[model samples]
Target: MTNMDTLWLAPALVCYALSAVIFIAGRLTRTSRASGWAIYLLGAGVIFHALDLTARGFQAGNIPVGNFAQALSFFAWLTALASLLLIVRLQMAVIGAYSVGVVAATLGASAIMMKGGRIVLPASLQSVWLPIHVTLAILGFSMFVLASSVSLVYLAYESQLKAKRPLGPASERPPSLEKLDRINYSLLGWGFALLSLAIITGAIWADATWGHFWSWEPVESWSLTIWILYAALLEARLTVGWRGRRAAALTIVVFLVLVGSFVGVSLIDPGKHGGWFG
Candidate 1:
């Protein structure tokens, strides 16, 4: 990484840390000022994150997706961006703590894994479809992640209500179950659409580079599994009138599958996609 890249990392870390604190404060104090601070911090982080991505692109002379570290960093920022947009729309600053934590963890992991060695892009990843596929896939994943977080929060809030307990710091100010359910559905819809687009682009890229569109590679298989899970969740929500706890539980399962696809596959069976981290 260049000096420019390293410089951006500091600002990004600071933003995430500050956002996390502000989010917690907002939830605990029920103060709009805390949420406002979170928004500011998130905006600063996004700017720095964009700068970092630009630096990487400049270094690569193309869209950079060669190694694992870059992919992780990109996905982290994508998640942060998606979460911030949702927070703005929903006015749910309570979710900021979880979202910022995810950003910080991913960024820290990427920093640890990032090697300074230059990587040559695989021939198969050179087509225009590469960018579309990656962007959509990352966006889809981000949405799913956000949905999962909201589901978890919903469950926690429900538990508190059932027990008639006082709300804790994190649970002090949360949206209603109905609102969380609606957000989850919206995220699922958006995520499913993006996932479909990603799969289509992946198929096209595969055909262009490898002469085949569907090879059932490990990464491909796992991604398909996640897609199917989310599809089922959506169907259940619409047809079965699944809501509240049931819907949140299903979303939790889907997110677990997503995590397995992202982390488990890489560890269990290294394949063409194994080079993502290195």
Candidate 2:
């Protein structure tokens, strides 16, 4: 990381953090311009983030996913890009609030993880298979993060309805349950399909490199577990006529398992895939 890189990245990180704050405040106050401003700030952050990451990648001769810090920074960048896609089409500014909050939080964590240090990529991480697999993993997880945020918002709104509480000005603006549910369902399909392919590609990589496709590594085991969990959720929802509260609850649960698999297990186990960084 060069001093010049830090000079540019610092503002981007600041913008992301500011965007998170603005999103939350906008949600709370029902401020109309807050959403637009949040978008603007997020856009700036994304631009700077891309530039900074691109510079780093050019310097390193790769996309910078060799270690936990680099992986997370790359993931956060993708999540922000994904959030922009989700936010532009939806009228739900509150969803933007929820989405940016997660992105910002993740970026913050990435900053902490990277903390003026660079990763030393191992042979495995430098392989073509690693970035392809990790990119898919990040995409899958980004959907999970967005889905979970939407789910959380849906549940909160659901609770308010059940409580018969007057819609506080702040809470009045969340999207309808039907809309939220539809987004959640769509995200599940996207996340699952991509993650399934990720598993296959990962296995291929494992076989090519490790001479075996399945190591039952802790991360691999958890990835399969999460895949099955989402698969079941999708099955029950589409075929079993599952909908509403139960499905929403399951969405939240799936995200928890996802977090455990992506971050928790990586921290504790840091298997062959993660051994280079942690």
- What lDDT does model 2 reach? 0.80
Question: Candidate 2 has what TM-score?
Answer: 0.91
Work out the TM-score per prediction: 0.91, 0.91
For 1-278, candidate 1 gives per-residue lDDT tens digits of 55766878778878987887777676566555668778888889988988888888777666666787888888889988988888898877767777777887887888788777556676656667767888899888888888888887788778888899845456345678789888988988998999989988888887887799999889888888878888888898789898899999888887887887778888787576775755
- Candidate lDDT scores, in order, read 0.80, 0.80
Over 82-103, each residue of candidate 2 has an lDDT whose tens digit, in order, gives: 8877887786667767778877
Off by over 4 Å in 2: 115-120, 165-173, 275-278
Clashes of each: 3, 0
Report the C-alpha displacement of residue 184, candidate 1, in angstroms: 0.8
